[model samples]
Target chain A: MVYELYYWPGIQGRGEFVRLALEEGGAKYIDIALKPENRGGGVPAMNKFLEGPRVPHPPFAPPFLKVGKQLIGQTSNILLYLGGPLKLAPRDEAGKLWVHQLQLTVADLVVEAHDTHHPIAAGLYYKDQKAAAKRRAEDFREHRIPKFFNYFEKVLTRNRTAGPWLVGRRVTYADLSLAQVVAGIRYAFPKASTKALRKHPRLMKLHDAVFERPRIKRYAESGRRLAFNNDDLFRNYPELDG
Target chain B: MVYELYYWPGIQGRGEFVRLALEEGGAKYIDIALKPENRGGGVPAMNKFLEGPRVPHPPFAPPFLKVGKQLIGQTSNILLYLGGPLKLAPRDEAGKLWVHQLQLTVADLVVEAHDTHHPIAAGLYYKDQKAAAKRRAEDFREHRIPKFFNYFEKVLTRNRTAGPWLVGRRVTYADLSLAQVVAGIRYAFPKASTKALRKHPRLMKLHDAVFERPRIKRYAESGRRLAFNNDDLFRNYPELDG
Candidate 1:
């Protein structure tokens, strides 16, 4: 059965991490919220999942995946579960744990990225919290971007077996996650990411390498890989960037 | 061998979650940074782990537990690992996963709690970002607190077993973590939590039950349990709470 992925339709958001893995692995899946009849052409299905009582273990929010009877939420947990089946994770327990750790870190970075635009409240409009968002964006660009990017770069450099992939020779979920992060940063803060990439050669190479992968290339060009915009985590706010 | 816990000495911070589990289970462990000759104390140890030579899998941040040679970080991951040996988690996979999901939700709340104070940057002083922090804190108190508390309340209400524990008929990490969250909320937003508790009877019952547990009672009474202060995740700011 195809995995049912439930997330916001338009932007890649957190769901993109899961989507990339499924896309690159060529897994059979359906982006449920994007479908018309399934969701009644809106986010009601996603809302129903959140408010519904049928799920014994209900997800707190979206970007959740349904595999058979099991419903898994939390972006990192979803990736961890899919990693083995999709061949996006290492075989060994230690390596698998490492991949999960990397994914969790990526999740952390993603949260920080989102906070750059909506520091005050997720429910509030960006215009309502512009001042706070501006301050948060500055901190993100100055501290968080460098801190997270440098850490990933170090991991890439430190990996003795594979210089590019986060864990081993295989392209695990971490690799796909890194690629998306790089792409988001470039779209959001072109100048900062360009300057940051110079210090992290291996990370830059990995970002370039992921795009060259046949499946990933197809996914990127298929229009399914949504472009980063002001609506997503990596918003290109000129004032926030500098 | 005793488990090695590495976190800053003063505040309960994130390390408190691990500390509570260890205390309840009566696990043999040492809070590394609290001891003398600890090689420049907790801050140094934390920074070293973060900025030091890259391990095969680097932890994003501290509150990591070292059992033998394996170094595990991330609060939920550490709790999940310790939960088994400490008898703080369910033996069954499904139960374990549920508890983990609950713990991850707790981690999310903890992040939001931290953001209330340090909305702009972890590196910046709270005073420097007080304006932004005020707005962020308002949203947290008004929106996040109720959202998280209500979700957990529903989980407690939905448990068919009628058990106080989140999973089965036993106290798992979720129960302990929930107790801590309750305590933190009470400290941080006494007025708000008092009002909110009226609507969440099951959660309050669980909190009351956890407080009566022998080990937890001892831990709370002992000088070891750090008091809630401005330094911790849940802090008192009258303006923010209102």
Candidate 2:
């Protein structure tokens, strides 16, 4: 059976990380929310699984995966489940945990990116807290992004043999998620991320290399993949970009 | 062999979640950063392991558990590793992921709590970012905390048979970490959290229940259980409290 993937339809958001795994590994899955409601899709369809009586383990938010009777949420948790089947993670337990840890850190960076646009509150609109976002973006663009870049660079430096991938010698979910992060960051903060990306050649190389992957490149070119926009996480509010 | 846990000394922080698992489960471990430098433990000791050549899997930050040559970081990551041997998580893979999802949400709340005080810059002190923090805390106090409380309350309500545990009948690491979040929130925003906590009696019960566990209660009363202070993730800065 094709796994059912639930997430908001329009944006890459966190769902893209899971999407990359399925796409790159050629897993059979349906983007449940993207389909028509009559055919058991749309927000309401996703909501049923979220709070439906059938699902004992309700997801707090979307980007949850459904297979048979089992449902899993949290981007990293879903990746962990899919990693082995997809062979996108290491075989050893320690190796799996290492990849998961890196993805969790990527999740942290994603949160920071969202905060840059919505510093005062995620519930509030960008215009409502524009000033706070401006200041917050400065810290994110200057301090936070660079700190993350440096940390990842160090991780890569420590494992030069691995080259492009963040962990070990093979491409893992961590690399896929990191590639998404670089894309989002580059889209959202073109000027700032350009300079920042330049500082880490290995990271930039990984970004280019991930995009160069036949499957990933085809998926990106395939219009099935959504583009990053102002409405999503890692939005490019020109004013917020220092 | 006793596990070597490397986290910053003098604060409960994220490490406490790991420490709670060890203390409550009665696992043998050392708080590496807390030991004297003369005896081969301190910030340097922790830093050495962070970037150490011997560690095949170097963690991005502390609160990493060192077992033989493998170093696992990230509070939840460490908890996931320790949960098995400690039997603090469920036996089934699906059940384990469920508990972990709850913990990751707890981790989200922790990040939100930390951001309330340092909305502008983590590198900057609370004193330096008080204004932005004031606005951020208001949103957190009014919207964020209640949302998280309601979500957890719903989770607990769904698993009423489990009572205070949040999962099934047994007390998993999620319950332990959640109890820490409740305590830290109460300590940081006494006025707001008190009013908020009243709405989620089940969660309040879970908080009380976890604290009342024999080993947990002993750990709390023990001088080794560090007090929550301004320097930590959940600090009671009276000015920031809404």
Candidate 3:
């Protein structure tokens, strides 16, 4: 069965994590929001599961995946479901949890990165909370980014496997997600990310390695992979960037 | 085997979520941070996992559970790991994912609630960011709280099973987490949470029901359950309350 991904159109946002994994896994899936209206696409089609009274498991927000009749919500949760099936996660229970743990950490980092631009409120525009955004972004760039990057670098350093992957030797969804987060943060804060990442060679190598994968590289160059924009989570606000 | 929990000693914080589930499950576990220094408890003990160079799966932060040799990090991940063995989650895969999705949503709400006070930076003092906190709290009280509470209430309303729980007729970890979130939010923003919760009776009832469980009630009344304070994620700042 083809996986149906429901997310806001025009921006990669959180859905990009799932898209990247799906692309690498060679899974048949449809970006529901990007499809034409008649074929069951657009915001309204996605909203039906959210707004529909009968929906068994209504997602609170976008970036949900519909597999068969099940609607999996939350970015990390969606990745957890797809990880095993898509062969991007470990087969053992402990290994799977470890990969999922890493993904959840990436999720945490993403939330913090998003908040750097929209500190006060997601509903409020960045312009409305630019002052708070500046302060938040400063802390994010100086303290948070280094701390997170250091943690990931350490994880890669501690991996006993011969390969550069976070868990065992082969690539996991966590690696893909970590690369996405790195790319997004770098896009949002080129100067700050560059300096912070300077101390994280393993993380940088992993980021480049993930993107260099054949499927991921093709998908990245493919017109379907949306470019980073102000409207997305990782907005490149010059003033917010150090 | 007794589960070893590693978190800061003073605050209920995220560890409380895991504690509640352990209590409800009647599982053997130790609050490692609360124990005396001689018995391998306290902040240093918790820090070893985080700071140690050889830790295989280093947790990004505390509230990690050590079951045997494996260290499970992330509150939701810890709950997800425990949910099955503790019999607090569903037996089926889809049911488990649905419950986990709900827990992740609660996790998102908790972050937003915490940010209402520290909109600028978690490392910064609340007093330093009081102006931004006020603005963030206002939006949280007026918009975020109601939206989250309403979404949860909708989940309870749509649970096809004839029960008060979010999944089937049994109480899942998501129900426990949702209750904890409501209680924490109510403590943080009494005025706002009370007002927002008024529009969602099912959520209010669910919160009350989860706390009223015999094990949960006993554990909560026990001094073991730390009192809500400013140092915790949910702080009762009257000025920040609507």
Candidate 4:
């Protein structure tokens, strides 16, 4: 059976991680929220799980996955569920834990990236919090971008035995997610990300390699693939970027 | 062999969640960073695993668990590892995933609580970002606290078959973490938390019940249980609180 994936139609947000993995794995799944509400999908269908009585395991928020009878939520958690079957993680217990650790760190960076524009509140508009956003974005683009990239770069450098992959020789979900991070950073802070990448060739190389993977490359060109925009988690505001 | 848990000595931070599990389970483990440096068990010992040559599995940060030769990081990841052995998680796969989902949500709240005082960056001091923090804290206190609690409250109400615990009648690591989250919030935003708790009796009762557990109670009063302070994730900044 084709799995069901639910997320906001307009933004990649956390859902893109799951979508990338699914796309890479060529996994049979439906992007439920991307469908029209008239077809019994989209935000209204997703809300049923949020507010409906039948959903004993209602997600705190979306990008939730429905595999058979199970409903899984949380980006990292969902990635974990997909990683095994998708071969996006290692087979060993230790490797799984390590990959998960890397993924969790990626998640940490993702949240910080989101906070750059929405430092005060996710509910408020960027204009309302521009002052705070400026400071937050600077801190993010400066201290955080380097720190996180440095950490990943270190992880990549240290794991030579496993090749260029974050955890192993194989392209796991972490690499795919890293590709997204790099793209998001470049899109949102072109100048700063360009400056940051100038000294981090290994990171740039990994992002390029992940993007070039046949399935991912094909998906990127596919009409199903959405472009990064102001409405998404990684919004490009000229004033906010360094 | 006993597990070797490493974290910064000064703060409860993320390590406290792991500490509570080991303490409650009466598990044989050494809180490495908490020990005196003279005995080769302080930050130096922890740093070895982080930066030293001996560690093939260097952690990004502390609160890592070393079991035999394996190293695990991330609070929720470590708990997910310890849950089964500690009998703090359900036996079924679905139940375990559900428990983990709850734990991740608690982690989300923990990060938000920390950000209330340091919204600009963790690299920056609270005083440096007080203006942003006040705004962030107000948002957290007014919007996030209720939204998060309301979701959990709904989960608790929905999962009545499991009894009072978040996952089931059994107290999982999530409950322990929830207990910590409550304590941290109360310590940081006593007035706001008090007001919030007035409307969240179920959450308050869960917090109290977890704290009152014989093992947890003994551990809390033990001298090893550090008091919440400014250095910790949840600091009582009067200006930031509602």
Candidate 5:
């Protein structure tokens, strides 16, 4: 059965994490919003999910997946569900839990990154709160980026598996998500990420390894991989970047 | 074996959710941070969890639980782990996933609440970012709270069980977290939550039911349940509280 993913169409926002997993796993799925003739494209679909009748198990926000009758939401939770079936998570319970904890941490970093651009209100335009955005961006760049990178670096260096993947000997969704994060940081704050990467060799190596994976390489090379832009979470504002 | 919970000493903050679970389940555990004579008791332990490196899997933030050799972090993840063994989660995979999604959504709301005060930087003083805080709080109160509450209201109303709990018949961690969210909203935005709760009868009923539980009732009556304060996530700032 083909998985139906519902997210904003244009930019690779939070949904990109799920997109990356599907792409790397070579799983058959439809980016519902991006498909032409789908009146229930991004905005409409997101509204349907939000404003529609109360689901017995409601998802708070977008990037939810529907496979048959099962609708799964929350980026990390969705990824956790797919991890096992799509071969994106570890088999062992302990390993799976650890990977999940790492994903939750990544989700925290993503929220922080998004907030840097919209410090005042997500509903309000970025232009309206540029000054506040600058301040928040600085804190994110100086404190959060380094802190998160250092943690990921520690995990990569400390992994006893002696492999490039975050868990066990195989590639997991954590690696894919990490790659996307690294890519976003590079696009949004090139200078900061480059400097931070110098001290996180293992992390950089993992990023490079993920980039070179046969499936990941094909996904990136293909036109399917969305480029980072101002509309998405990791937006580039020179004033915000140090 | 008793569970060992490490979190900040004074504030109920994020740790209260875990405390509620332990209390409701009648589980034996040590709140290392709250104990006296252990260098301010739990605070030191919480700090050690934050700063210590000996542990293989270190938590990015506090409210982490240590069960034997396993160290679980993230409020929802901790609850997910405990929910199963402690009979807090549902039996089936679909039910478990649904509970997790609910917990994660609650986590998102929690982050939004924290951002209201620390709109600029988590490391900076709230006073320093009063202007931004005002703007953020406006958005949170005017937009976010209603949206989140409505979604949850729908969830409770749509439950097949038509019961007070979030999932099936049992009281899962999602229910506990939802109760906390309701209490936090009431504490932080009394006028708004009171108005909002009227529109969400199911949610209000669930909140009342959770509070009425014997274990939860005793826990709340006890001094262990910390009161809302400026230092915690949901602070009552009249200027920000609409």
Candidate 6:
């Protein structure tokens, strides 16, 4: 069955996390919001599912995956649902929960990353909160990024059962997500990210290995892959990079 | 099995979310962090798991549950695991995912509520970033709270099968979490929360019902329930409320 992904078009945002999993999992899915409006797509199409009275389980936000009649929302929740079906997560109950726990941690880091640019308010433009953003970014660069990276690096180092993957010997959705986050941070904060990467060789190795995989490499080179821009979660503001 | 919960002492922070579930679920559990450190409890016991090399799966932060040898981290993840055994979640797969989706949304709202006072940095004192906190609190009061409350209210109103609960007719972990968040927000932003609650009667009903439940009410008045203070996630800052 083909899965339908509903998210805002143009920017990667949270939806990109689902997209990475879908690509690596090799699931048959359509990016619903990217299609033209006449063919039942775009933000209007996405909003219909959200606002329509017929939907019993309406999502709080996008990055939701629609499998048949089921609509799964929240990036981590969507990944959890798709993990087993796509063979991207462990078959055991305990392993799946561990991978999901790691994903949630990544989600937290992502929120902090986004907040660096919009420290005062998500509704307000970055320019309006530029001063506050600068302060937030400084703390994020100096503290948060290293703290998160160090945790992941330790997790990787402590994985005796698995050679390099987060959970087991095989790659999981968490690995793909960490790779994406690392790439995004590098783009957003080149100097700081580079410094942090030097301290986290294991994490860097996992990030590099994830992209080198055939399925992921093809997706990365594919025209469908969106470029990192100011509109996305990870923006290139040199001043914020410290 | 007697489950052990580890978290920071003296605050009803994220740990309270887990405590509410454990209490309502009628599970036998120990509040390890609140226990005497001499008996393998308190912050030292909790830190041992975090910093120990023997732990295969280390949680990034607390509100972690130790069941036998397995440790589950992330508040939502812990609830997701306990939801089934304690009968706080739906048995069916679709229903479980839906409830979890709702829980994740509640988690997002909790983060924003905490950020009202720590918009600049979590590590920095609120007094240092009072100016930025004021700006962030304004947007949270005017935009974020209403958006989240409206979404939950709509979810409650649209839950045809479940009636008033977030999911099915039976109380789920999401409902308990929502109730906690609503109470926290009321403490943090009295004026804004009151205004938002006025518009969402359905949500307030759910919140009230959750606290009014026999087990929850017993726990509420058992003297174990911690008071909301400045040290907690939801602080009562009069200046930030407006």
Top DockQ hit: 3
For model 4, what is the error of residue A53's alpha carbon versus the real structure, in angstroms, after optimal superposition?
3.1
Q: Can you write out model 6's per-residue Cα lDDT over A136-236, one digit (the tens) per residue?
A: 99999999998999999999988887466888898999998999999999999999999999999999999999999898889989978898899999999
Candidate 4 clash pair list? none
**Model 3 TM-score?**
0.99
Better of 1 and 3 by DockQ: 3
> Which is better, 1 or 6, measured by TM-score?
6
Task: Please report, in order, the local distance difference test score of every candidate based on alpha carbons.
Answer: 0.83, 0.88, 0.91, 0.88, 0.85, 0.93
lDDT of 4 by residue, B98-206 (tens): 8888899999999999999988888888889998888889999999999988887788777767556787678899989998999999999999999888888888888
Q: What residue pairs clash in candidate 3, if any at all?
A: none
User: Where does candidate 2 chain A have its weakest 10-residue lDDT segment?
Assistant: A49-58
Model with the higher TM-score, candidate 2 or 3: 3
What lDDT is reached at residue B114 by model 4? 91
Task: Give the per-residue Cα lDDT of candidate 6 at A153.
Answer: 91
Q: Specify the highest-lDDT model's number.
A: 6
Estimate, for each residue in A40-95, the C-alpha lDDT of model 4 and write its tens digit. 88899889888887688889999899999899999988988788889999998778
Kindly report the TM-score of the first chain in candidate 2: 0.97
- Evaluate residue B98 in candidate 5 and report its C-alpha lDDT on the 0 to 100 scale: 89
**What ranges in model 2 sit over 4 Å off?**
A160-163, B51-55, B160-162
Order candidates by lDDT, high to low.
6, 3, 2, 4, 5, 1
List model 1 lDDT by residue over B1-242, tens digit each: 69989887788988999998998898889888887755655567656676778555567788787778778877877887787889998887556667877887888888888898888888888889898888787787788888998898888867778678777788988898888888888888788888888888888989988879998889889888888899778888776676
The model with the greater TM-score, 1 or 2, is 2
**What local lDDT does model 2 show for residue B55?**
56
What tens digits encode model 6's per-residue C-alpha lDDT throughout B54-168? Answer: 7899999998999999999999999999998999999999999999999999999999999989998999999999999999999999899989998998898888774569886
Query: Which is the winner by TM-score between candidate 4 and candidate 6?
Result: 6
lDDT of 3 by residue, B1-242 (tens): 79999989889899989998999999999998888888877888999999987888999998899999999999999999999999999999998999999999999998998988899999989999999999999998888888888899999989878868998999999999999999998888788777888889999999999999999999888878989888999999999996
